[model samples]
Target: MKILVINGPNINMLGIREPEIYGRETYDDLIAYIKEETKLLNIKVSFYQSNHEGNLVDKIQESYGKYDGIVINPAAYTHTSVALLDVVKAVGIPTVEVHISDPDSRDEFRKISYIRQACVTTIKGKGFKGYIEAIEYLVKHHS
Candidate 1:
């Protein structure tokens, strides 16, 4: 199966940003891990990361008819972007929302996620492993 992995804003700073919360693994490390894990599952995965909200929305729109599923870590956008939620809904592809940190455990503002309702599932607090979990779920369920 083929999957699209979309990461948003500041996710590129995975290693340098917050060691305590996001772990010491670099963004490259995260990508490597996902690639390695999915390789074992015989899954084809494409990745996209952007600090721009419009780019992310465009990517989601572009995934239509091209990808089997989407694993998205919308980062800060998870709590806000209705545009993203709309596009995901419009695309009608199976989507899994991932968060490295549990948003409900953080600031009150972080607890709200506009994208959750649009996703088939939400994986949080599992760090980089959450991405793999989402991929596995899509492969097993969506495929």
Candidate 2:
């Protein structure tokens, strides 16, 4: 099994921007954590992050036969980007939405997510562990 991990917009600033909500882990730290977790799983994984919506959309659209499952943290795009959602729909892969902080506990705007309409599993408030859980579930359910 192969999995694609996509992170969008300002996620590259994870540790520096908000230590309270996003935690103090740098993007490299988070990537290392994901790599560590991936070692025990029966899948190969690739990770990508971009501050651009179009790049993320393109990456999602590119995942079709190249990947089996996707673990995505659409960041701010989760509430706003229909284009990103459309690419995910087009790819038709099993996806799990991950949030470092619980969107429900944040601003009202964050509470509404169009991506959730398409993805059944949303892991929130667990920090980087959400990424781990999402990948594991994808392995159990898809791979």
Best by lDDT: 1
**TM-score per candidate, in order?**
0.98, 0.97
Off by over 4 Å in 1: none
The 10 consecutive residues of candidate 1 with the worst lDDT sum are 35-44
| Window of ten residues with lowest summed lDDT in model 2 | 112-121
Residues 1-143, candidate 2, lDDT per residue (tens digit)? 99999998999998899788888999999999999978978689999999999999888888889999999999999999998778888889999999988999999999988787677599999999999999998999988
* Candidate 2 Cα lDDT to native: 0.90
Best TM-score among the predictions, by candidate number: 1
Candidate 1 C-alpha lDDT tens digits along 1-143? 88999999999998899789999998999999999888888778999999999999999999999999999999999988999999999999999999999999999999999999999999999999999999999988999
* lDDT by candidate, in order shown: 0.95, 0.90
RMSD of each: 0.6, 0.8
Clashes of each: 0, 0
Off by over 4 Å in 2: none
